[model samples]
Target: MKIFLLTEAGKNIGSGHITRCIALSQAFIEKGLYPYFVINGDNSVKDLFKDKKYIIFNWLEERKRLFNLIKTSDIVIIDSYLADNTLYKGISENAKLCVYIDDNKRIDYPKGILVNGGIYSLKLKYPKKRNLIYLLGFQYTILRKEFWYVGKKKVKKNIKDVMITFGGADTKNITTKVLRLLTNEFPNFNKKVVIGKWFRNFNLIKKQKDERTEFIEWADANKMKELMMKSDIVVSAGGQALFEFAQVGLPVIIIAANDKNQLKNINEWKKTGFIEYAGLWKDKNLENSLLNKINFVNNYNTRLQMSYNGKRILKKNGSLNVVSKILQELTNKE
Candidate 1:
């Protein structure tokens, strides 16, 4: 079967969409199917596709080339924030089996499968239609293969290590701000800061790096899982990484960094008792909110409960579940 995964990522666009798509692609590879990635992104994304089959181009602008490439594809999965109705329609008409990975029902998607693996996806109330096959909620959450079967996290009594990640781009430079805050307020705690490839504010972050701060640059999924396992808690952006944290049972303080739409997911995860919502990045009181939450999470009982809630809420087999469904659908179509 010819499978093509369409997505975009860059310094400006962030890497959430591409990251999740990579998870899904890994699922396909597990099933002995190699999927080609058609990305409209920058060079920073190349590191993610080391051994994978992919081509980089501006699919949004060169629609003709994209359509030509996917015209004969048996399955086409598109995850993007920039694709419009017409573009979706074109892919739907061309591919034998079309899958639209959604977050907020961004558009009236063309006929095919609609996969919204967000924790709050069902709450969005996607319209029921005969043409659409709905794969909603956390059961379909696309986690990286490394996170698919992680053992339970060991929550420490005292918060010695803290991991901070703000997506691949850290477009709003939240990592630097959070690192600075931690360096000043919690000097004793070891800080594992993930520095993305597109981090333009690395100089600022480097300046704030103290004896307790460890800078991790462009960590792969396995390395990320390792860092999460070692950390007592994580301060992260509201993105695909939340599900991974949940899978590993890491207590999280979530900040809505670049995307306001993340507020819904952040609020939902907060309700689960696993994550503390630290408000949006643009908020004047965000730093205060984060500090307060960090102090609250310092209690051993609170961290334990957060860890328990997170492990209970998410299973480590979400990516496999999604793959099973997609393959089943394909067989049915045949």
Candidate 2:
């Protein structure tokens, strides 16, 4: 079977869509299927599709080119928030089967498989449609292979090690603000900050670097897993990073990125006791919220329970499970 992934990634758009699609692509490869990516990303986004078979086109000027790829492929999987209803309908008409990967219902789906693989996927309301196969909640969450089976995290009594990550693009530049606040509070502690492939404020972040601070650039899934495993607590953005950190049983303080859906996810995670919500990055009182949450998560018992809660909530082989379902659907039609 041939799978064509219709997605986009960049500094301004963030990499969550492309990253999750890559997880699904890996799963397709493991099943002896060919997956081709159809992207509209720029040069900076090319690194994300390093070894994968992909073709790029200007979606605005040359979107007609995608219909050819969709027509040839057995399945068309879309993970783009920027795509409109007309784009999805066009692809759906051409492809044999259409699968829409969604975090938020940002757009009207094109009547196929709709996967909302997040913490509160079960709670979100969807439009009524019989043709849509709903793969709701964490069971279908797409995670990298490194996060599939991770060692349990050991929470330290005194927050010795900290990992600060705000998604792949981090367009809001939360990493710098977070580091500034955290280092002042606990300068001696081991602090690791992830500078994404698209992050523009490298000099600002580099200026904050000291003996205790380490800045990692362009960290792949394996590298991210390594960092998550070593840290006692993580101050991260609410996206795919949440699932990865949760899989590794690391306690996290979530700062919602630009999306309202992210804020919804963070609040839901807070209720589960797996994470403490530090409000939106754009909030005026974000500094105060981060400070309080940092101090709150310092306790050993609190971090320990947070670790356990995260693991318990996200206990599933997400990528593998989603692939199995997709493959099963493909074979059943044959």
- Model 2 lDDT tens row, 1-334: 6788888888788788888888888777777876888887887777677787888776645767777656777888888877888888888888778899988777878767888788778877888788778888878988877777888666777888899888777778889889888777778888988888788888887777778998888889889988988899999887878888888889998888866667777778888889998888889999999999989988888988898988887767878888888777777767
Going through the candidates in the order shown, the clash numbers are: 0, 0
RMSD of each: 1.2, 1.5
- C-alpha TM-scores of all predictions: 0.97, 0.96
Our tally of clashes for model 1 stands at 0
After superposition, candidate 2 runs with Cα above 4 Å error: none
Scored against the true structure, residue 203 in model 1 reaches a CA lDDT of 92
Each model's lDDT comes to 0.88, 0.82
